[model samples]
Target: MIIKKIIIRADASIQVGTGHVMRCLALAQAWQDKGGEVIFILANKSTALENRLLSEGIKVVYLLAETGSYEDANQTVDFAQKFNAQWIVVDGYHFRAKYQKAIKDFGIRLLVFDDYGHAEHYYADLVLNQNIVVNNKDLYRNRETYTQLLLGTQYALLRREFWQWQNWQREINPITRKLLVTFGGSDPDNVTLKVIQALDWLNKDDLETIVVIGGTNPHHEVLQKEVSNSSLAISLQRNVSNMPELMAWADLAIAAGGSTNWELAFMGLPSLVITVADNQKAIATELDTQGIVIHIGWYQQITLEKIGMVVQEFIYDQSKREEMSQKGKKLVNGYGARHVTSKMANMLS
Candidate 1:
C-alpha cells in the first residue's frame, strides 16, 4: 500500500467556478483509484462541491475563511496534521506565496493548479496549468527549474468519461438547430443571458436551446425565469450529469473560454466562445487563431449584435462549420484525464 494521503484545498461557487473543483475531484478520484487516501479541505461556505464530496464518502474538513487574511492556511495546517497528509494541493487563485510558505515546514509536497500565472509561486513542487498555448517561458521565469511543469490539454485533468466518449461520430451534416450555452458552473458575469439573447435571430420554432447552470449559481433563478418566457424550446438544466451526451448532441456551443472549451473540442462540437476572465484569454485566442472555434471577446466587449452575426455566419456556411468541427475533433481525443492521471501516478512511483 502507498499509504500516502493527499489533501486538496479548493472552493466552488460563482467567484471560484466549478472548473477548479471538478478538475481537482477528477485528480482526487485518480488518487483514490491508485489506493491513496484523498482528503479535501474545502471552505465551510455553501458550494456545489459540498454535497458532491459528502456523497463520494471522501474525508473533508471545512475551513472557515476570513477576507484578506491567512487564517485559512492556519486552519488547513492543523487539519493536514490531524489527517497526516503527505501532499497538499492548492487549487485556489486567491492563495499567495505567504500562505503556501506557512505550510512548507509541515514537510508536505505542494502542488499548485494555476491558469492565471499573474502571481509569483515560490513554494510549489509541481505546477500544472493545462492551457493550450501558454507563455511558459515568461510565466515560469522566477520559479525553480526543479518545478515539474505540466502544460497543454494532454495533461488536462478531465473525468474518465470524456476519454470514453472521445470516439464520437463526426457531425458531417449539421442541422444548426440544437445549441448548448453553458458559461462555467456559476456564471458570475451572466454570460449565458447574453448568449441567449443573441441567439434570438435564429428561428425559434426550429432551435432547441440547452442552458446548463450550476446549483451555486446566483443567477440560476433569473436564467430559468427568462428561459421560460423565451420563444425557443429551452432546456434549463441544473448541474446535469449527462454533459458528454449534451455536448455531443449539440450542433454548436456558446460557452466561456475555460475548461469546457476543451470539453467541447473533445466532443467535436464547434463553438463560439467568450472570455469570462483574463486567464482564459490566451487559450481562447489560441483556439480562435487555430480555426477551431469562433472567439468573441469578453462579455463587456461582445454585444448581442456581434454574437448574432457570428452565429448566423457559422450556421449558414456549411464548409466553414464542418472544417472547424473536424479541426476541433482532431485537436483533442479526450484521453487527457488518463494521460494526466498516469503522469501523476508515475511521479509518485
Candidate 2:
C-alpha cells in the first residue's frame, strides 16, 4: 500500500528548542521522496522555521492553542481529517498520553517520537525512542499492549542533507586546531556565550573557531558582539545550510548533548559535550562512557577554566582524538533516517 499523506505534529521555539521539528522534517523528507504528501501542525512557530518547511515543499498548519492542550489535539485531529493523513507523527515532550489517545481515538494511525518516555501512558500505534541509552521495556512499561516500540540509535532520525555524506571520509589531523561550537537551537541558558568566553580565555593564536546558532536563539546579538570583541578568531554562522561541511572541516567540537551529538558522531568528529538540559544527561554520560566524547559536567557546573583545560588537552593529544573519532563513527553509521523511513513504509504497506 502507498502512504499518500502524513501529518506531523511538532513545534519549534526558544523554550522547546528545534530538535523535535527538525527530526520530524527528516522523516517528512523521506516520505516526500517516496511520493507522499506531508503537512506540519505547530503551536509555537518561528518564521524562519516555517520558511524552511515551505522551501522543502511541505505544507504547514499553525495551531494557536497551547501545546498538548485538548484544544490543540482537537485542531490536530481536524487537520488530520482534512488531509486524510495516513499517519500522524507527534514529537516533543509536551505531547503526552491524552494527546496520543485522542488522535488514536479519531481512528488515525499514530507514530510518536519520544525521548526518555515522559508520557504517563502511551496509546500510539508506534512509540519511537531514538536515544542511545534508554531501556525500552523499562521506560514504556505502562504503554498499551498493541503499541510497538522502535528504540535506540538504530532509528535515529537525521536530516536529508546528512544522508549525502554517508560515504564521506574525514581527514583526522594529527594536531587538532580547528574547532566547532554549537549548543543546540535555543540555548536558552546562553551556554554558547560561556563557551566563547572560555575560548577567549584559552587565547590560542593558532585555533580557528566556527560558531553555529539557530534562528530562534535570543542571544544572537550578544553572541555576535562577543565574537567581534574576543581575541580568538571566531566565525559566527547563523542558521547554516552546510552543517555537514562544517562538521567535516572541524578537527574537534564543543557542543551541547542533544540530537546534534548523533550528527557529530556520524561525521566522526570528536567533541567535548556539555549537558545543557536534564534530558541530555544520559546521552552525554553514555557517549562519555563509550569513549566517543569527553562529557564535561552540567553547564552550570562547567567553568571557563575547565573548558579551556579540556580544549588544550584535546588539542595536544593526537592519540585520544583519533580514538574518539574511530569510536564515534562506530556508534553511528549515518543511515538511521533511511532505515527508519524503510520501516515506516513497510508498516504502512
Candidate 3:
C-alpha cells in the first residue's frame, strides 16, 4: 500500500527537549524512504522543531501559539483537511485523548506515538511504544476500541545510521578507556553539567569522554564555556548525527534516562543512568532492576559522590560490566524502526 499524504504533529523545545521531534523525524525519514509524501504540523512557538524541519525541507504548517491544548487539534485538523492528509501522527506527551478525538472526524487515520504509559489513550487507531512494561488494556482503557498495539524495543524509533557502522568483537578490556555521555537532545536541567562535574572527580587523563549536546540546548553556551579551558581531552559534539557509530565505539554510556536508554541497549552499551525528567524514571527503574544500568536517581538528587562510586564500580568490576552489556544488548536489537514503520504502513493501507 502506498502512503500518499502523511501529516505528523510533534513538538520540541528547551522545555520539551529533543526526543519528541527526533523520533518523528526518524519516522518521517522512514516513510519518505518508502516513497510516501509527508508534511509536518508543528508548533510555531518553539524554534527547535521548526528549524530542524525546515532544514530537512519538510513542509510544516505551524500553529501560531504554544498552547498544548485540545484546541490545537482543531487548527491541525483544519490544516490536514485542506491538504487532504490521509494519516495524522502525533508524539507529544502532552497530547491527550480529547485532543486526538478532536481530529477524528477529519477522516484522517490517527496514530498516537508514546512511551509513557501514564494516561488512557482512547482516541488512537494505533498506539506505538518500544518499552517492555507497557500494559495496553490499562493504558488505553478502551482496549476493545480497535486500537492496534505496537509494543517492545523491536519498534524503537532509531535512525538508519545506527545500522551502517562496521564493527567486530575486538579484544579490549570492557572496563577500560572509552566513556560516552549523552543527555538527550536538550539537557534542559543541565544534567550534562552535573554529570560532567561528577566525572571531574574521576579525572583520569586516559579516559576518553565524548559529550553529545543538542542544537536547541540552552546550556550549550554554558557547557562550552565550562569545557573551553579544560585540560581534559574531551570531544564536545553538538547536534550529532552519527550516534550509533559513536555508541558502537564506546564501552560505556553515562546518559540521561530517556529513549537513548533503549538506543544504548540496542548496541549493548551498558550505562550509568541519571533521570533528568520525571517521565524517564520508570524505564530507569526497570533497567536498573535488570542490571543493565546503575540508576543514580534524578538529576537534582544525584551527587558527585554517587556518580564517582558508580563509575568506580563499573571500572573495577570487569565481569559485572560485561554482564550488564550483554543483558542490555539482549534487551534491544536494531529492528525497532523497521517493525514500527511496517506496522504503520500496513495500517495506512
- Highest lDDT: which candidate? 2
What are the RMSD figures for all models against the true structure? 2.2, 1.2, 2.3
Candidate 2 lDDT, 109-205, residue by residue in tens: 8999988879999998888887889754888998888898888887887788899888887877888889999987888999999999999998998
Question: Which portions of model 3 miss their true places by more than 4 Å?
Answer: 1-3, 45-51, 54-57, 118-121, 165-174
Q: How accurate locally is residue 50 in candidate 1, as Cα lDDT from 0 to 100?
A: 72
How do the residues 181-298 of candidate 3 rate in per-residue lDDT, one tens digit apiece? 8998778778888767777776777778899998888888888876775667677888876888788787778998878887787777778898888878888898898898888888
Per-candidate TM-scores read: 0.92, 0.97, 0.91
Candidate with top TM-score is 2
Q: Please give the CA lDDT of all the candidate structures.
A: 0.77, 0.88, 0.76
lDDT order, best first, reads: 2, 1, 3
lDDT of 2 at 127: 86
| CA displacement after TM-score superposition, residue 136 of candidate 3 (Å) | 5.6
Better of 2 and 3 by TM-score: 2
